[model samples]
Target: MPEGLPLSHAQEALWFLHQLAPDSSAHNTGVAVVIRSAIDLPALHRATDELARRHDLLRSTFAEADGRPVRLVGPDGLAGLEVLDRPGVSDAALRAAVEAALAEPFPLRERGAFRTVLVRRGPQDAVLLIASHHIASDATSHLVLLRDLLRSYEPAAAGGDPTLPPLPGTFDDHVGAERGFLASPRGAETELHWRRVCAGAAPAELPADRPRSAGTPFVGDVCRVEVDPEAAARLRAVAAESGVTEFAYLLGVFQGLLYRSTRQADFLIGCPTTTRLSSKTREVVGNFTNTLVLRANLARGSTFRAAAVSAAEQLRAGVAGIRYPFPLLASRVRLSGGAPLCRLTFNMLNATGSDPLLGLLLDTEHEDRVVPNAGLLLSSLPLPQLGGELDLMVNVRRSADALAVEFRYNANVFERETMRRLAGHFARAIAVAVAGPDSRIATARLWDTAEPARS
Candidate 1:
């Protein structure tokens, strides 16, 4: 065993959070890629092994040493894939298998934080399960892993030498760089900005079906709704006219709903920002996700266009000032009895580079996630079982054709019907905003159970 290296500040915070509920799988995250083409099982196994070796974080385990978190880089052999042959398994069975894999928590001190499972349902159809501890991976890391796996598998499947590129740096090097920056003058300046931002932040809780638990649980449920291509196109037009990205428009709609839901004009919302500040860290796979808290103090009778423009400005600032670690910032803010600083999370994840990969034929590509209805099949996954740190997360993804939103909420605190109603309200809010960006958002008639539908 190699001597453990101290984890990045972000990783250390995640480690401490995971330790809070050692048995829960709330922090587990992964992606399941379904391939309907011929998969050379042996080649895939070798490819995964090589990929893990290339990225030290894939084989990273964690434990505490002298009161600080340390990452244990396990051997390459620890990153091998587990193949499960389920010839002619039913769709329900396949779903159950995927769920089981997702629910499996990592033994942080024992094994590496990554696992790969190949479930073969037939000769040509199989689902690849790639599970990783959130502390070890993030949204971009998932794409990086998939890109490398495919690149590695293509040649290995053909019995040829793989042409995988060398990673520019390792996760350890990232930790060292982060430490150096955090100790410098710029770090202190960033910390001060964070303190100022967080000092005004409070948990923006929504009305729930039931009271919150003393300690949050990871029990999760998802409700998905899609903005149809027509609606999406209209939104695009509105965004173009407003001179803001579609995300900013969607965010403005969400902020409008938040104002209505909470009835608080001044509240904080959390947005996830990537910490890959430079191209140097682009190819390196590790946890570089940062959570930024933005103030949503919408003015009464403000137009959605104005809100979106303001949101766009905040987003730019947030991205530019996201070098500070979120955990450390959260720690700096003093909450009442250790309460969370923010509750509602609104994330508009951009799905790029995966579409071309999907268009290739099964035999030539050797992988197929071809879906007749892209919105339903590519809907957002459930929220990260972050031990119910937040009551609700609005995860939106704008695919090639449609804009899909999944309201992932705590089952313990929300009923399915409540979420369904909320989803409807969100759709209405966006539809109204798309129709008239200049209209006052507060004046828009959001749906209520008692209010009859507009004729």
Candidate 2:
């Protein structure tokens, strides 16, 4: 939380990415959390206006007026917010209002890069809706924005002064760095490297479960899976016995799940990195995140535990070298310039604060705002907590009337009940390997389950 450092987060990283690839469509994603309180609407608007004024980045938008990307800094007058007052509205009605606002096509060719739709859910509840274009926002940013807005709201409450920091750098600085990098010698080498990596390698493509549409769709769903204390203890024991990172064991379990769900051995999955490599810009807020891909090579005879270990090794190395920007990688590996390398990103979010007011002054705070089309498999449950029960959320896309599922399982394949039963199966398989390194993955469960022992 110290402002003395120079490390950057995903927000700053994304800004740099946009500067490198202004036409990249994978940049949009944000979210809105409905907070219900008997707060004054006029006061809230004033606060929002004030908030926008305080942060230059929030006041700016991505633009291409002359066919060159530029920051469209917002006018102080237009920073005002509006709360749609709809009293006596049901949940369905509230949803309808949101849907209508979402349905409004984003005017990206215009000046600002984002939009806000404030709707009243009830006398006490209101929706602080944010609709930001992909190039300028993402989920992490959404959270930051919310935290700040709420903090700023308190001061805007009593007409008191809000404390805000002087931004050491702007989004433009990120773009400038990316631009310079892209034109440098390292940039050329990186592009060539990427071309070879992706060359002749088959793309991980998901078959459409339904009809394909050219229409821009934003369908999404969330599934929550928690690992309780008892199970987590077993997991820890197994991980220790196997001599691998807990994350590696978890990835192995996920690969098994993916194999069951998708029936594919190889997959391209992305996880997030904090991207704060140095101390100079540590507290500097912006998109400082990048994606590290895990390509699992599961085969018919591969044991679940082996897969986990393999995954762990890959992650350890990948996480260490995450300083490499993925946009640059795409250029390096010489993949199609327009298409992103990976689609399904397994984002293990690590941005939650230990202290709610970690680096905030009483006068100002930042909330988590989001970008368009963030990622799947994004969950943020801090490590080493609770009855071993940990929370995991599977986030997928859907505008409305869609569904998502979490394949739940205990650490025993036979005792598990899933169409694929991969999570349960892999857990048991890996646990055995942990308990006995040389044990076969197909061997019986190392631990008992709700079901009786298998013959």
Q: What is the C-alpha RMSD of each candidate to the true structure, in Å?
A: 4.5, 10.6
Model 2: lDDT to the true structure: 0.49
lDDT of each: 0.75, 0.49
Q: For residues 1-455, could you state the per-residue lDDT of candidate 2 as single tens digits?
A: 11111212333344555555454433444455555446656556766766577555556655433333445565675445755787879877876776555445444434445556677756656566665544454444555565566666666667765545554555446545655666788757655544544564433433333433333232332323333334444655676666786557666665555554455666656665655455533433356566676677777666757777888876875665565577556544534434346645443322233433222111011223222111111111111111101112222111112212233211211122332333344445434544554433333353356644332
- Which 10 successive residues of model 1 have the least lDDT summed? 374-383
- Measured by lDDT, the strongest candidate is 1
| lDDT (Cα) of model 1 | 0.75
State the RMSD for candidate 2. 10.6
- Tell me the tens digit of each residue's lDDT in model 1 across 109-152: 88868888877788766777778888899867876787688778
Model 1 alpha-carbon miss at residue 210, Å: 1.2
**Candidate that would win on TM-score:** 1
TM-scores for all candidates: the values are 0.90, 0.66
Off by over 4 Å in 2: 1-28, 183-199, 205-208, 211-218, 223-229, 240-244, 259-267, 274-289, 320-324, 331-340, 350-455
